[model samples]
Target: MPQDDKISPRKPRRAWPVAMAVVAVVAVVAGAVTWRGQADDGAPSPDHPRNRGTELVIAVGDVAGGEFDPLKGWGSRPAQIRLIHSSLLTVDKNIDFVGDLASDYSVSDDALTWSFTLRDNARWSNGEPVTAQDVIFTYDTLKKDGTRFDLTFLDRMEARDDSRVDFHLKEPRSTFVSQLSDIPILPAKHYGTDYSANPIGSGPYVVADYQVGQQLILEANPHWYGQRPQFTKLTFLVLGEDAALAAARAGTVDIAYAPPAFAGQRIDGMTLQSFETVDSRALTLPTLPAGGKGKIRTNDVSVGNDVTADPAIRKALNIGLDRDQIAQIVLQGHGRPAYSLVDGLPWFNDQVVFEDGRTEDAKRVLADAGWSDSDGDGTVEKDGRKAEFTLLYPSDDQLRSDLALAVAEQARALGITITTKGSTWDGIYLDGKANAVTWGGGRHHPHQIYEMYSSKVIDSGYNNMPQYTNTTVDGYLDQALSATTQDKANEFWKQAQWDGQTGFAGENGDTPIIWLLRLDHLYFVRDGLNLGDQPIQGHGHEWALFNTLVQWHWTS
Candidate 1:
């Protein structure tokens, strides 16, 4: 790492005090506004004109697992993990797979063998040369207890030499290329149980300092083989949305990740940077009926919803609610209507889109299915069962809470009572199987769609919560994974979503889940801080915002 011409790469003078345990935005803002003294090291504050393009400070959402372990789901998204680690492959700005550490890559004609030729110059920050042994060790270690990549397709992996590696699969899968980008190559010599705390990698940056729950400082890695980043020093602060916004206002942070709720606000020296994303929220209604067989997860936790089990009730909710209106009210026009989890992706079937916001259409569908307000109680019923169910959202997530509340309100017009409540993520996981839960997830690939709808992995680590079962859908999903080419696979993936006559879509279609909106990730960025041509974000994970950090530069 460079020692000269770089901002202080040691401690962050304005580091949020973990000992004080202060979380209030007003308190932090007050302190930032009141303390106008120069740093003890005499380094200009990040907001100073002299340091406009030399350094950067970013505020991000919570750190998963509070550690940077690649095996424990740290480098799963296009995030900071990319800064400290190298992979055989990586995604470009458009979320397209491209070679990273590997100088060249190719797949076998059988579509089961994948090969990568590593670049010779790649070296760890410690000056150790990266080797094929390290790549094999990464996969072997992940196979034991990995929480990020789905290794179902990977049968075996081997290294041909220091600059060569190959992966053999049990089956053909188009997502295998994307999965390669998720696993960060680990150093075999320094890897162990304690590697998470003290890490070394072959990426563009070195971890200079890290304060648990407070801040992280990174300096440019001098041994990096890739393009040099313009800025040499970077600091990341973990703060709640309120405190992050306050920091941006106080000129203590260069960029602050915010939700649409704060998109209307303005900062003194910052510009609102809104990037479109495939990240969306969907109300997953369990397809299984209560008191039925296979209702229990592997852990014995019961899962299923009686009301949502009725396809007609699910379809009614999907047709009645106006998604455009939800985007207007809940997201404040920062988002748009979404039909399926893979909307805007190549495999998405736009034919599933239908006319929404029609109360009469919803009522007619319900009535044809034998649900009506016979007693005039403003609630539809059929065979003594009322059309109502509880909806759950993460208590801390304001976007999801707003979405759930809006959906509940819209469903009222169709006499379908929806009870909305905010709960913890753990609570939602256990209880969500029996109730409709507003969940958020979207990536560039179709694996998530298969996992959520496939019956083969029901209740297997939150996959297929609906326990939806359709032989045709399952066959399509299976064929998607087995398709030899990406284009062929996309066709099958689309068929799984909607085959015209029967599928997972709403509007007389099997509606196991009702997707509402695709949101835009809004950020408060310092003026003249150009984020280059950033790719459209598919995952909601805040870390993905740093995907184009290498392309950032200053205009003035």
Candidate 2:
């Protein structure tokens, strides 16, 4: 679970918007015991690693870019969200959000007003009782003003009493309850205005100590009402890939987050667990920027003009990429090629497949659009101007840079000169004229489409980089959200997908962005690490590493 879709204000700038770019990262159902060759006699294998009593040390992929403010960077990044914090509702692997703090909850008849009953027995680490005021205060303090990394979902929240709370919505939102899973309930007494320095939480783990950019130390909360963690201390070491891998190989780190290049390698006395996700690597077309400091263009236009506003161009660009090749070759057959943003979900429509990357068809499509070669140069020209553009991506993400280079290579063949530029995550989307970048995440759900392409989200500085808008798509989205039956909602959702591809929701008629490949999200763990009875994490990280943490014991 990459935590790509959920937006939080206090999140690390590097991981925020970019975390969602990976394609094909999805939550997987737990494998059955029979499938793993468990003996019917109830005898365990002699060499099987099971329940080794020891401390668990994890090495995260990158350093924290911002403070450990759960309200800030920690809210958006799945790794941080799952380990360092726990929300009011905990979602299963199947993406069904179950109760965490609240013992039970029910929706109003109209689905407009929702009420929750807090667990009377729940208590914070500081021995303060968990009450309705904590929930209300958490929402008010973190969500009311909104943050750069936080998602904008709540309209207002009110506490009816110490044990009950009511959420009043502006309109009926089917996903409102599920969305509450994004906010981690904080103690009202601790986190008002002066809580940033001494943050307190009720999750299984609490922040023991934090170094600005080096590491965050989390100790298991002995007071947690749920099952106690086996490890006394969980250390999240933040470092670059090289340092992280080195630490993992040396056994200085227990869990490590690294790229595929690192996953392919083996370490002695450790284990590797390769898991798949529905996260797709993609390129976002930015709204063209007019002018800014140290930047000026001969023709000044709105940011949307940079790219994604043209249907034909976006379609041609999408059709040109050889997604299959990228999947099989570049990805080593880890993932499938994607046509739309919806990457991996059982409900995903299989009818759509665009594998023409680096093909003559894509070149022809662009050529027919009045872009052609001029002056005998390889690149295309339109109206005596070279069809040239620059794309910016994060240098830290190898897949993004590779995808950009691949697109640039194909663009050259099509007479469209696309230059590739790499920068830090913060700078990639800074001024918005960078053109495009690659992103990935878990499973393709309708919520992903709404979040990425919805016309209503542009102002939030999210995935609507192309500034695409369409009534037909919006209508489909509305029907999908309001429909009582999943079947009817799915029907409308499928129609929305079709309409989106037909230019109703995308950049004109063609997708403003070409979904290159559904990145087969992978993670490595030590040998004999069996996660028993895991949940299905549809499109988020709730199910992948965090949920299984409770059941995971050293089986060495």
Candidate 3:
């Protein structure tokens, strides 16, 4: 905490598990009982010893891969975005929408149009009042020229005046407000076609300097309409663990998002803060054909093979995974068991169970599907072809790589052979190819379904890597996206999960995507920093919660 810098530390009161402190310790012990904690009373306490600071430095395990532009790829990483942005609306832990830039908002009768009333007094760093034109301009820019990252729900945008703006939808979207929460309103005057390089916005912090792949320095924006940030200057230094750890351990940086493997190791005069997470590391097994020979896309077999098309195969693979062991051994209990796609979202239904780790069930499913161990070899074979494929994960992400290898071992026991491949993210996900490995999710919402499997993203296939395609599931997705009421929308959401589980598109009891674990985003801050109110939903890692930076403060 530096007074001259006037940076107040804000403690983000994220939920903690009973096993938080034990994760790294257990990983080191190599033999410890896994402890579980209830989420009922796990909010951050004001009197806790760890929460305090001003001008805190956080160690993030991974730096954003690209520039901090929504049009580019790095826009989705929540840690990088906090340096310069704010969303229009905020989602609380309970999945309620709160206004940010807008004072209030309302949906039309048909739910096809949503209007937001802007805060007339809100002003940009340049001392210009924030108007509806900024909103319209942002939407228009992304709609016409934005990259895939910035184009959600931006089919049409209209501005009536400085105080009001409307979003015309292609369909009645129940989660339109949540979707809008991802868009930050950039200044209309300063941000135009050249905005990506010289970005200007009415957010909590303004970019002071940018060094690609090196660092980004920021300064507080004085003209913000809400509570101003305490820190006058903030620096985001890009460095690897060896450097980040040296910075933190040497007291060069006060905070850092260190790796889970390095979690428990302590630096003199510094405390190690830990929290439970819903962020699970799992892989996508592509079920579609390769080389454009089948349904989804035309590409090499590098992304996925036609093997995932079998539902029984999906179920068998899922049932065989010992997620508890992975959580304990691979993740050191830093993660949770995941059975559904929305590991940390609001709509995550806890009723479903997939954790028997039953190899017999896996064997039964495969046997019924005509796969068997014929050549007297331990591995299952189908018509002289042994079940074997390569599982690919980001070369830089060790957690995912470990998970892939662990799952592969389990599949091996079931007479299935899975190999692991580490590759560059661009080659794996971008470049219009699919991979058998990738993991990501946000606050549980209907858009998770749309974004993951929707035809709109088949080209990039950012999250939906399985090359999974089905008309029945697509119909249910369209229903949920167009529902007029939240209750109706909820029904569609449930049905979608059921449809996925039922294997209605292909096999009744088979599924393509088998969820492995759930995650609660965890962040560690310097002592005395006030994180302010955080939404339990959406993991507060999305654009919706970036505004919390404005209200964070440091106390003596």
- C-alpha local distance difference test of each model: 0.79, 0.58, 0.59
Candidate 1: misplaced stretches above 4 Å? Answer: 1-19, 23-28, 31-53, 78-80, 291-300
Give me the displacement of residue 366 in model 1, in angstroms.
Answer: 1.8
Model 3, 1-556: lDDT tens digits are 1123221122112223436423422221221121122232322222222223345444454443444456554445433454465567855545567787889899888887889998877887777888888888767766775454435554587778778998888778787765466666677778544555566666766666554444455677777677767766666655555456555544444455555555566665455554443444555666765444222233333444655655656777777777787666566656677776664354444445644688887799899988998887787777666677677777766566777778888888888888788888656654223346646555534566666665445545354566666666667777887798877877666666664554322223335566676644443345555656655424322233343566667756
Name model 2 segments beyond 4 Å from true: 1-53, 63-70, 148-160, 287-302, 305-309, 344-351, 443-446, 478-489, 504-508, 531-544
CA error at residue 435 for candidate 3, angstroms: 4.0
Which has the higher TM-score value, candidate number 1 or candidate number 2? Answer: 1
lDDT of 2 by residue, 1-556 (tens): 2234222322322332324322111101111122123423321122232223445555555534335455554554443455545566766667565787778887777666778888776778676788888888777776655643333545677778898998876666554544466566777767744454456667777666554444456678777777876777765655555665665554445566656555577776566664556566777665333332222122232354433444545676766666776666556666667766664454354455533654687677767877767578787666665667777877866667777887787667666677888888666555344466565544323555666667766545445655556677778777776765445666666666665355332223446556776654455555565655654333332224666676777565
Task: Give me the candidate number with maximum TM-score.
Answer: 1
* Per-prediction TM-score: 0.90, 0.81, 0.81
Q: Per-residue alpha-carbon lDDT of model 1 for 153-205, expressed as tens digits?
A: 68898888888989999989887766677678889998877665577889888
**Ten-residue segment with the worst summed lDDT in candidate 2?**
23-32
Distance from true location, Cα of 484 in model 1, Å: 1.1
User: Candidate 1 local accuracy as lDDT?
Assistant: 0.79
Q: What is the lDDT for 151 in model 2?
A: 32
